[model samples]
Target: MLNVVALMGRLVADPELRHTPQGLSVTTFTIAVDRSYARPGEQRQADFIDIVCWRGTADFVCKYFQKGSMIAIDGSIQTRTYQDKNGNNRKAFEIVANNVHFAGAKNANGNTGGGYANAQPEYTREAPPAAAPSFAIGNNDDFSVIDDEGEDLPF
Candidate 1:
């Protein structure tokens, strides 16, 4: 069977690292993923999804990601059965993250600040002059041509 999932969204809350009894690190958090479509007169909708990260991935997320930060996750869907305090059985579904990444541009401290929704391109400069270059391509005296005998051909 094949199971894979990829999601990019803003975190609903900061990830808090925890340790299992076996001393393995873990963290659970939710992200708000916007739906692809909406009714013609309605506002866009978003779904809150639960995500689980383990070990190094958990620690990394807790250290670098926070509430409102955009995150990209690659993982598989997982479901579990458990009993809540009321004694009713329930099923929970979440993404078990295999990889997590920063989804926004880095700020001054080399940390991603605003979410991807407001991220700016990494490189920005003034636009080039509208007119074409003054130099003529074939008439340039700086150009040179070489005759190849094929003996030194790389291919």
Candidate 2:
């Protein structure tokens, strides 16, 4: 009975925001989700998924997220049917987002947009491990070598 879909991917283009007659906000965008598996010697494939958000989520996306921004979306699949130009019925599938999150690295300006309602600190990458302390004995005045004490020492 679960119809939830969760995906993390990069946006293919800026989200398009629209307003309904009643003044409800809506945004539609596509994201490129890379396939998990690829054949040897072949490039990995990506699926362009259509996503839809309503009201506040739509406004948040338009205010921050942009093309090529990585995002995590949690939603349910929805299919709607409409008539094409030739009067043929067409069905389109999309995710109706209940949650939107930012997942990309910070830019040079140090902004990761936002996750959910605002930027989630959990998305930030950890700093690289610090370099190990130097242990070599240099030719400094502080080092003194003793040979008669029978004390084993590491140089």
Candidate 3:
């Protein structure tokens, strides 16, 4: 009854944007997701996944995303069947993206250039100092963990 998926990967190529007869926008793209494990002496493998975005999401992707852009996707897996040109039935699988996020690295100018001119972060320094750690190493009265008697913590 529950269906959900999350992926972080780089775009295989620029998304193909198109309009339906009803004038609705749609965009299709592929992302290369690398596998976490590989056999010894073998290189890591990657799987190219197809993604579909509709309307506002499609427009945002076409305007901002480009080939090789790293992206995070939150959506659900969809499967459908169609006949290929060879007159054989085929099954297609893709993600129906509810949200697509920017995942590319920030460049030297502190910009994440995913085809769109990047925006600068609030802490705009050449290099920021390391942040201080919050937790105490030894016992500290202020940071005591209360046991919940094997019950989930109340929200």
* Strongest candidate by TM-score: 3
Quick one: ranking by TM-score, best first? 3, 2, 1
- TM-score list, all predictions: 0.71, 0.73, 0.74
Superposition-based RMSD of candidate 2 using all C-alpha atoms, in angstroms: 9.0
lDDT of 1 by residue, 1-155 (tens): 99999999999988899999999999999999999999999998999999999999998898778998889999999999999999999999999999998886666666573343345467679888899778866785876776687688897
Per-residue lDDT of candidate 3, residues 1-155 (tens digit): 98899999989888878999999999999999999999999999999999999999999998888888889999999999999999999999999999988888876665563645445436545876799878767858777787778668676
TM-score of 1: 0.71
Listing every candidate in turn, what is its Cα RMSD in Å to the true structure after a full C-alpha superposition? 8.1, 9.0, 11.4
C-alpha RMSD of candidate 1: 8.1
How many clashes in each candidate? 0, 0, 0
Candidate 3, poorest ten consecutive residues by summed lDDT? 113-122
lDDT of 3 at 132: 89
Model 1 lDDT, full chain set: 0.88
Collision pairs in model 3? none
Off by over 4 Å in 3: 108-110, 113-117, 124-155
